[model samples]
Target: MLQRPQANEFDSYFTKYVYNVGDKNINQFLRDQEQNIVHLYNTLSEKEAEHRYAPGKWSAKETLGHINDSERIMSYWLLSVARGDQTDLPGYDQETYVNHGDFNKSEVAALIADFQRARQSTLSLLDSISPAAWVRTGVVVHKRVTARTILYIIAGHTEHHMNIIKHYGNRLT
Candidate 1:
């Protein structure tokens, strides 16, 4: 098990919550997680994906959709910050996003494909950045965060959600 990178390794551009993700490069981590995500998605049938562990919780489809949305938004942040933009990025309302996801009606296969596409785009964008770009600091949600830390946080956030899906929803049944 690889422990997260130390705090000081990245600039303090991110909020304490995200900065806590430590040293994993956001793009690299997402690339690595692709295999695990694919495997997990493939293991489930349409019915399995729709099954939620509890009422009001997200189903597997919704979770996948959320990951796709999250990656896309994070990618946008990465792109702007990587270009040396110092603008403050706004935070999103996750509950609002989830409520509108319509996961119950979406096909599981398409949802995962959307996630893969978004992640791939994010990776391509990150891979193109110059070394100096990684060190740039920007504000998000009133906290200073470096591009490097942002990347790691994005990856870790997805992993965190995936773990929840596995343990609570996917594994329960």
Candidate 2:
């Protein structure tokens, strides 16, 4: 079995999921994420997507929505960090967000498409930045954070959820 990544493995699950992405390659982790989203989407059947791994846990659909919401927020955080914003970033209430999210009513294909589009948009924004910007820092959830750290967290965060989908009461549809 693939060893689980540390609980705090990727520093911030927000960036570790997508760090070490090749600067020379445009694919740069974001594409990988889009692909993973698609892969997971395709893996689940219509009924399976609605399956909840456990009582009170998010269903596959809700998990996809979580990924979408997180990427959107993290993209903004990335931009702020790149711009050297020092203000503490706001904390998100995942449970609240999921509760308010209507993923249960959304189609699987749409969720995948939305995630891909959002990720692509974020990557486009990131690709336009100067190298110096990558070193800039910002505050996230009241903690000092850097642009690079945010990127890694993105990848690691996805990986974290992927693990859950794979083992924590979920399986390939």
Candidate 3:
């Protein structure tokens, strides 16, 4: 029964992501999301996965790869803060990461598999966090955030991308 973080717990830029989360138990929500996302992605054929909604946008596979990368980074932030790490974590450039990922070259099933493994690792790390540590704060990209804030961001970020991926349905066919 982890509580939702307060408005002040995270940066204002993250409000959309945090607000995307509902009243559901964070851990359960994450677990359910993992399955739902996998099922959604599994429905797409490899050729379909390569379809971008428009020019200059990410393909479905690249979007999933971005989601996987973001979750891993946020999970690391969660772990670092929960463990009382005082170091200021650096932010990454999503474009650079995605360009280097070469997700377009991989099978859709393989991308989904990578997502599953990354999410499972995130869940395991979440389980290891102590009750008192949820309130632990750390700096990321120069903004102070709590461990719980990072958790909500992770969930919200996925939901944001999921919505985008769903919208691709209209054009993918």
Best model number under TM-score: 3
* Model 3's TM-score against the true structure: 0.98
TM-score of each: 0.84, 0.81, 0.98
Q: lDDT values of the candidates? A: 0.75, 0.72, 0.92
What does candidate 1's lDDT look like per residue over 126-163, in tens digits? 66888878777777676666676667777877887788
Model 3: clashing residue pairs?
A: none
| Arranged by lDDT, best first | 3, 1, 2
lDDT of 2: 0.72
Q: Tell me each candidate's RMSD, in Å, in order.
A: 3.7, 5.5, 0.8
Model 1 Cα RMSD, 1 decimal: 3.7
Query: Which residue runs does candidate 2 get wrong by more than 4 Å?
Result: 1-27, 168-173
Better of 2 and 3 by TM-score: 3
Clashes of each: 6, 13, 0
**lDDT accuracy of residue 165 in candidate 2:** 81
Best model number under lDDT: 3
> Candidate 1 versus the native: TM-score?
0.84
Residue 163, model 1: lDDT of 82
